[model samples]
Target chain A: MPAICFIFLPIKYYYVRTHDEGVAVNKLNKFPKMLTRMRDGFLLNIGFAVLSIAIFLVIWYGLSIFLDTAYLPTPVEVWDALVDSFNTPDPSLGVTMWDSIMASLKRFVIGFVLALAIAVPIGLIMGFSKFAGMIGKPIVEVFRPIPPIAWVPFLFVVTGMIWGPILAIFIGVLFPVLSNVIFGVKSVEPQLIDAARTQGASKSDLFAKVVFPYTIPYMMTGIRIGLGIGWMCIVAAEMIGARGGGVGIYILTQANIGRYDYMFAGMVVIAALGLLTVEAASYVERRVSKWMGA
Target chain B: MNRSVLITIIVAVLLIGAGGAYVLLSSDDDGENKTYDVRVGYLAGDLHQVARVVASDDDVNGGESLFKENGLNISTPFAAGYANGGSVMDAFAADDIDIGFLGSPPAILKSLNLKIDIIIVAMVNSEGSSVVVKDGIDNFTDLKGKTIATPGVSSIQHLFLLELAAANGMNVKLDGTDGDDDTVFYVQVAPKDMQAAMDTNQVQAAIAWEPYGSQMILSGAGELLLWSGDVWPDHPCCVIAVSRSFAETNPDTVEMFLKAFIQANEMIDGAFDAGSGETYDRIITLATEFSGTNETVVLSSMEHMDLDYQIGDNFETYLEDYTQSYIDLGLIPGSKLADRDYANVTEYVEDLVQVQYLEAVD
Candidate 1:
């Protein structure tokens, strides 16, 4: 676990040390040295990631052998199932793994983006305007704690199958992002607001220059948390009957038919996909933070 | 933030916490579990497994449930029943039940897949399920490029649809979210949700066990395309499966359970023959209550379903054919027979379906 976290360790240092010399000749002369540092860091990250996964696989293999049951399939068995999924229609789901992933990915991305668009602005308004808070807080609080899976039947009935799973993801992601952004806006320093006001800034200017930038980090935190929750929602959401095959359905179908190896293979794809999304969010955060010099 | 208000809030929170815990624990009652000598599981709202409801009812057997008359205590852990055969098999694997009534395909699928030590003790019913389609969709080819709902791949309904699609030489697969490619796609929906799925146009057709099919027809949601019986006469649908270890440990108890089950089948047969009399009305009422459908749907369902416990040579052949179909569809690998120390599908089926307890009865 710690080895995998090391991947992010060199990222900040690599960027923080880059000198912006405003087109100076010395910056050009030092480019090769910087490239060497980047290459070293990249290799270290890759090495640590490989080591972490290797340790995980060893532990899993040992446990499977120790248990000696068909329930816990070996990594080799899972790997074969995973490879077969791409080439053939899944034994249970009747679609290639690639097809499943694409369908699920489409739902996830659509749901995630929708959550961000709707939630962030509402959170900002509710936090900033007391009247808005009076109205919005009650509604948000009422719906926030309801589990996303509980809405499977209703969503399917109302939104139909194609949009049902997507809405489930939307609901799962919405609350966390909304709550965090609200907290972020409210946590903005009063002193900073006063300074902006004294500097003859308009309401819009004050928000864009100070409030928005300060809230970025907190909003990102909410997004990271929301994305994790969103992935957890996929299984239950898609279980409502995704219009297309999905990892959640694949896992369920395999388990239903007593194909543990294939079930495990579905789980692996979901875990890998989840990790990729989280990493992508982090990378975006890193770049945004650097550009803003936060 | 007043001191008295704070105390009141804290006390209220504790009260709610205690209430929630009590509800949770009471729902999964150990006392009730201990009271039953044999715990049974069955599919929810499935009209095919009426023998179980019939066997457990006191009204039919002189004010005592048939199990009590046979000197055994039988109870269902889930009052509402499982949603499908797959879930029933899950309950057995989890040791939540000693016996289960579910589709034979799932009994075969999960037993070999998880290596769950269970034996097929008896057949529950033969042909009760139906393939229902929206109006104007008359045949197999018309079903192409449309969404159809199934309980899940673990269901015999799914197997039926697969076979139908193959016979027509048309392609069928899980819903790819894009179904314009001249391939019929199926989606997994609980049988209870079949009507809702159809209403939303998410599925143009759904294959489900009666009285769900009959219920939909009565409700005017869809029309029946084919009764399961129309396709395969005297087919094996749901069966009674017992945990092998449980049966071995309590052979007499298992026989007692089967005895009551066989008696229940006889009672059902008599009720069907009674022809609008009191016994027939009683059976309809019991089935309606058990399956949460109207008496109309139950009566309609009875006409299509054949309640039988026979696992004879013909039935054995049908089970073999079902196993072969699964292998051909890549649902179950041929290697699993060897994995379980069976030489082939025939051996696997023979080992799986044990009629010893049924024979021991009476």
Candidate 2:
């Protein structure tokens, strides 16, 4: 899915920005050569994506045929399972893929929002003030390397099932965003700050216009990395005890019952969702970078 | 250009590829793959499977395990122990273990669905599970509109929960999304964590295999609502299974393993009097260590459970009923029986179980 995303999302996102939003690229109809050249490059990328996906499918099918074990289902079988998951409830899990995704997505969004709420402010302060950084650095370093899954048993008991999984995602997403925000603050351009001050800008005005705008792109980068880790944490956490249905729970149930095809289907859903989120972050990063004239 | 050399290379590649494919597709070895130990797998920290632990004891067996005593190599595979029966089945799916002790439902559910050809050789234990409810949960009806914990859909204890709910005339559902006020919803929580889950109010009740029920009761966290025997008397829980290829290739080894297992079961049975003799004290200590619980909990657990190795006439019939329950819950597809090429559940059970190992023990 990530490999295909390297091809597919560029075209999809480009179309969404140019055609749907009627953005500046559409207004540059006068620059047909540049636009046409951009389109051609994108078309080549899409072609490569299709070719690679086809090759991957062929190899998968051939391996399934050659190995001839129930462990590896053909790609077509996986696709069918994936399609069927959306339309019907899994016999073992008794939840459709849509239901599972919604529950996971709710946890992810809530967790992401919570991370942003706490991490951003802390990161800004730590980066801006030496004393704050001194106090926070030791705690961050101590907790950073401990895996999210190590906390599953403790979290489930303390926070209960619903919030336990959410907190896992929060833990996964917090550090990257926090660290990146710190890096972004520390790396803010001295020239930009100097220019803002020379223009008679107040401290608040300089921070809002110069420091914050520069950090948006970095925050988006952290968010992209955090999103991937969040998915992984949620899946691992849910495998133990997820009260309401989740994609991880769905996959685990299928695996427990020896339904490899259904398990692969759940996995494919996660891959696709993870790719969609990263691509969305990439899109936001692009827009923010352009707005900041990067 | 170089036709002869090219042909030779092609033949060599063909030979190597075919050899690799055969190795991968083949189910068992020729009794020559014994670099490690016997690679026995069991559910981690489960007291119901203490039979294996007893068999593995060097002290009891006088400087070697029972398997070693019977002239068979016994080794604990580093990755062999699993948290649950479903994981033991997964290890079987990967062809990682020669023998495993897991729930019969997973043994039935996975072997048929995943096409893993493991045959159940003997019974491990039965009636070793109970439903523990938090304070104020007096009866089954009090469980309405609440979330309960079980191992998972494929576990025998989960089926016990469903059957007990139905026997009391309550509606039960998995996924818990559209459940009404009278419906009981279930979540998957490992037995080791059930006491914590109940203590935190994460789950109102939990149905788990013993030492957990006994552990929860002894901890003063929950009260026992139903023993598995109360639902279905002496129903099968966990059973000993062997990979078909392993059994077929290493028949003598398999026979020795069973002999050692039977000896362990006999020893365990003799120790059932609890602290009356040295054997009883040893079993209590072993049970406490193997289950990661207290001596009090182990003694309490032993009272509520039976450790039987024999599979009599009624077991196969109960297996069919268990399969039907899985089918009814949509956990197992009705067509899976046909997929396995069995005419019905009866044929499936007959093929699934092989009593020859147990019968040939003497």
Candidate 3:
């Protein structure tokens, strides 16, 4: 049975991929070069994501069926569970998959934004001034190694249950933004700085026109990385002790109570979030980079 | 402009990185710290009372100070909190906690592996769990091959569910632990998420203890399948434990804590004035503060739960049974703890449990 499922999925994915390819080929012959290029690039990116997902599911589903263990759910089971969770209203609490997703996204955005606001200025300073970087870099490095989960109790007690998740997510998101901004600032060429300086530009003018424009590309890169870290940190931050309302809280709660479908559903929401967030961030990054001509 | 600028930048980055590393590293290791403070870790559930008392209440502290004039300094290492018992054990190994409460399975597994000098201060609860099945499901036979959720793999619920599997003729195996081929399916989820999971139909069944089990039953997500406490009568679920070295050094503090915990348990168990406004107020506050449920719900739910401090035959027998289950689950090697005197943890527990303080205060 496991073997049959294994054989079935790849064949299905292969057919999907080929059908996409055939469509792409048909369009390519008629469309202009630039339009065709854009179409293929978009199709290829979507294809990679789907193919990866399909292959992973095939392997996971097959192994679970083979092992026959309760510990590991097959891909089909997880998918089915995901659907079941969305369709059923939780009997105990009114929390649905949508609720968990929204709660998590809200937390992620707040933390990520706070981190961005703080990390960018400090990183820009570190990049421009040798002295500031020297003083700040060591502090950033020390905190980076500590896992965000480690701080759950501290933030919970200090801030109480209300703001603990935000505090944790802030820590999780802070470091990446700082590091990336520093790299971005440093990457701007000396020639650009020299040209601006030669033009009698003031300190602010030089930074605003020369350094800032060049570094936006790097800033976007940092945002992308920071957002990913912040997203993953949702689980730890939402450890809300007993007042759990976030997706991580939702997942753990569901899992404990043997609500496999809801657990899977929560996981799917998180996964979709990661994918959606990364894509959105990436799109903004491309547009910004293009505008900056970096 | 030449060598000094480059050197300064390099030194600054290195210095900041080193400082960050120091903060992370020092937070983990406490074995060498000479400060004679009792760092206690507890699962956040019932310990809110203790936390409130520790931070504010004068009588509890004053009564406790009779044993030792030195007031204890308390610092919570929030990172290694009471969620997963493993986190507490990690802190213990690092010398962060003097006393802590952990679920039974993890406590047993750690005891077997580390040979760490720790003793069971007392068992927290000595009752089996209630198996919660989704609404409309009836009896254990209806659960054959159904997906279920238990706590962490080494938890008491984990062991009992496996025992349930074995009794029902399905061989459930722990991940990376056994070669057994049980057709039963179960996923391990934390207790807090069970309600949300049920609401979403993520699992068909779950095994929960006390307040949570009661919560599920009340919420209508599940109906009670044989309550384990009813089935096995006093199966141990949680244990309060202390680091041996820490306990020896901070004997007075240990006794004070034990007294307070026992008092809290008794207060929870003793029949209150059925009509006094204070009776319901405290229960509601605790339920809201700890469990996030309204007072009316917790006040009603408290009727079914037996929250007491008595150490009885059930604690001893369940310890043996649970420890064996840990061994069978391959969470702990049988050889590691085959010789420990389970029947007489009393000798170890006596020095740590200051019954005198509780007796004096009561």
What's the lDDT of the predicted structure labeled candidate 1? 0.85
lDDT per residue, candidate 3, A1-294, as tens digits? 344443354556545655675566645444345434634676545555666777788888888889664336677767876876667544323345666566667767777888888988998999888999999889888998898778876676566434667778888778877888888889888888888899899999988888878788888887888777777777866644323256786676554433444566677788888878888999999999888765
Note the B-chain TM-score for every model.
0.87, 0.87, 0.73
Model 1 share of native interface contacts? 0.87
The complex in candidate 3 yields a DockQ of: 0.02
Give lDDT tens digits, candidate 1, residues B1-362.
99999999999999999999999877635543433389999888888888888889888887998988877678779988997777888898788999999999998888877788899998888988899999999997889988889999988999999888878887777776554556789999988889988877779999998888888888888988999888888899999999999988988888888889899999889877767777677888888888888877888888888888888667888899889888887888878778899999899888888988888874
- Residue A64, model 2: lDDT of 98
Question: What is the lDDT ranking, best to worst?
Answer: 1, 2, 3
Q: What value does DockQ give for candidate 2?
A: 0.49
Question: Please, what are the lDDT tens digits per residue for candidate 3 over residues B93-123?
Answer: 6677877777656665555544445667666
Lowest lDDT 10-residue stretch of candidate 1 chain B: B27-36
Better of 1 and 3 by lDDT: 1
Where model 2 places Cα greater than 4 Å from the true spot, the runs are: A1-40, A198-200, B1-37
- Model 2: pairs clashing at backbone N, Cα or C within 3 Å: none
Which stretches of model 1 miss by more than 4 angstroms?
A1-56, A290-294, B1-36, B177-182, B275-282
List, residue by residue over B35-105, the lDDT tens digit for candidate 2: 22477889988888888888888777667777777766676564437977778877877777889999899
TM value for model 1: 0.85
Clash pairs, model 1 backbone? none
Stretches > 4 Å off in candidate 3? A1-294, B1-37, B46-75, B79-81, B173-182, B271-280, B338-362
